[model samples]
Target: MNQAPLPSYAPLAEVVRSGMREGVHYGAVVGLSAEGEVAYARGPVHDAMFPRSSAKPFQALAALRAGAPLEGTSLAIAAGSHGGEDFHAAETERILAAAGLTAEALRCPPAVPGGAAARKAFLAAGRSPERRYMNCSGKHAGMLAACVAQGWSTDDYLDPEHPLQVLVREATEDMCGERIAHTAVDGCGAPQLAVSLVGLARGIQGMRLSPEGSSERTIIEAMSAHPEYVSGTDRIDTELMTRMPGLVSKIGADGVLVLNVPTGETVAVKISDGDAEERARVLVGLTALRGLGVDVAPVKEHLTTPIQGGGRTVGEVRGL
Candidate 1:
């Protein structure tokens, strides 16, 4: 637990500028470090509430490390996902089968995949909608498999009181280096935890430092190795991993972004007012990572600053 150096940037000015953004006033905390020490911390480092989808890497890893027997597309789908294509659907089925389960066993809501093309394809193919097609279904399937491996009951698996959740909480704390201070329901009808930016950064660092075959490490590797499954082609997470070597990133609902660089730098950002349009999470995250010495050329090249009507630049966004 190395103490972070005081940020050279003035927090008062930073918060004020962020608050003035057109969409919503945003609050963020970023952590950057190498080895086991914290190099910098900004904004409110604690008390940020974010859903758990961003933490899916750790959850999926728990199943892999426990020897649930998944690999190839199945492993890729488990680690990285937005649930939009045939490959994703097939992989979800594969994981379910490997666990001696079926689509019926999934507790996630039934829906077509995320992208418009994926949904159109599903309808055109006359494939009846099933829970397995849901993007988060792969994650849920992986969790259930982990529970099965440990001989935990499959019923009420999504319950906050479930033993699997207890394990998840422990693993999450281990990765973030802090206990979850708040809890809520996720869009997938599963438990979500609230964590600080500092905690999220610590978690990313933990994932990078975690041992091979350890659940946390396994997930970080899988997602890093198969970024496309985590999101789709042209998706932020997918593109970031594809373009930036040795970096893994994920975005949560409500303008949340987390990034881990190969140099062991970790960053967590939350748009305070939750602006869906300004994409303040990406803007600030890319800016911060660039400042911390991440190779941001590709990001700037692929993700350009937006130009306004007068041919003046309004805002900029870095690619994945």
Candidate 2:
């Protein structure tokens, strides 16, 4: 294995202390094409980073390629880090049922809902967290479906040595148009592939620009068409796709965000400290898109987060 140097990140955004006029945080951004074209960039585009859940789209695409019978909301949820709302859980169940499986088959750990209201409702109902309520349940369900479809074993599907995992790794590398430099277990226990920020951008750009009828296109269309299934209400990924036409976005753990617009533009942002304070990833992402001559003004305000202090709006965190 070839070892790569740590990413040399440049400032992509700044968080200022309200009314104090001082920066508190810094991050990096990268914009590129599958063809290795650098459309716009900041920080280190060549260094490897864990894409986390942002890789869900590609993982879903791989499942589709593996003959998973996913469509509509099921397909969208497969590519989502959903809020585990009722609808989200139902959709996940639907996918598992389609595969002749059950929630017990999911390898990811059980967790409360990602949406605050849903979590509260769950606890109020005297219910405990279950695998179905895991935010990654949808993704795991889809993986199970793919296994069933391909006659692969449901047991140990999350293992890196599984055939399904091999397909996922291949699909990820293929889409990124680069080799995986490192691999680790993701939060949900799936294999996490590390690639350059430029590579991440390239992967999304490929999905956005893929020809009609391609699995890549299918994943992109499903996600864009059902943004609500992707992340639930009020989430940045859901809101961005819903409010912006011809746009697909996904948020990963540890402050990673990826966006692709219809015009073949792609952007990826990574906060050095993995702090998603005030939705900084989305703010910086929109800012990067704006720099690429994309008109994000319509949703700019929605993405710009208000910085508060003393229980009042003190300032704002705008893209740098």
What's each prediction's TM-score?
Answer: 0.84, 0.95
Per-residue CA lDDT of candidate 2, range 1-320, in tens? 87656567776555566556556446578876434479788887778889999899889988898999998889999999888799999999999988888898999998888887888899899988798888889999999999999999998999888999999999999999889988899988899999877888888888878898888888889999999899988577888898897799998989899988888878998887786554578888888888777889779694567877899888876666
The 10 consecutive residues of candidate 2 with the worst lDDT sum are 18-27
Q: Evaluate residue 157 in candidate 2 and report its C-alpha lDDT on the 0 to 100 scale.
A: 97
Worst 10 residues of 1 by lDDT: 10-19
Measured with C-alpha atoms, the lDDT of residue 317 in candidate 1 is: 40
Q: lDDT per residue, candidate 1, 80-195, as tens digits?
A: 55756777777788787878888888888888877667877789888777787787887888877877787888878889888777777777787777888777888887788877
Off by more than 4 A, model 2: 1-5, 33-36
* Superposed Cα deviation of residue 157, candidate 2 (Å): 0.3
Q: 19, model 1: CA deviation in Å?
A: 18
**Pairing residues by index, what is the TM-score of model 2?**
0.95
| Candidate 2 RMSD computed on C-alpha atoms after optimal superposition onto the true structure | 2.0
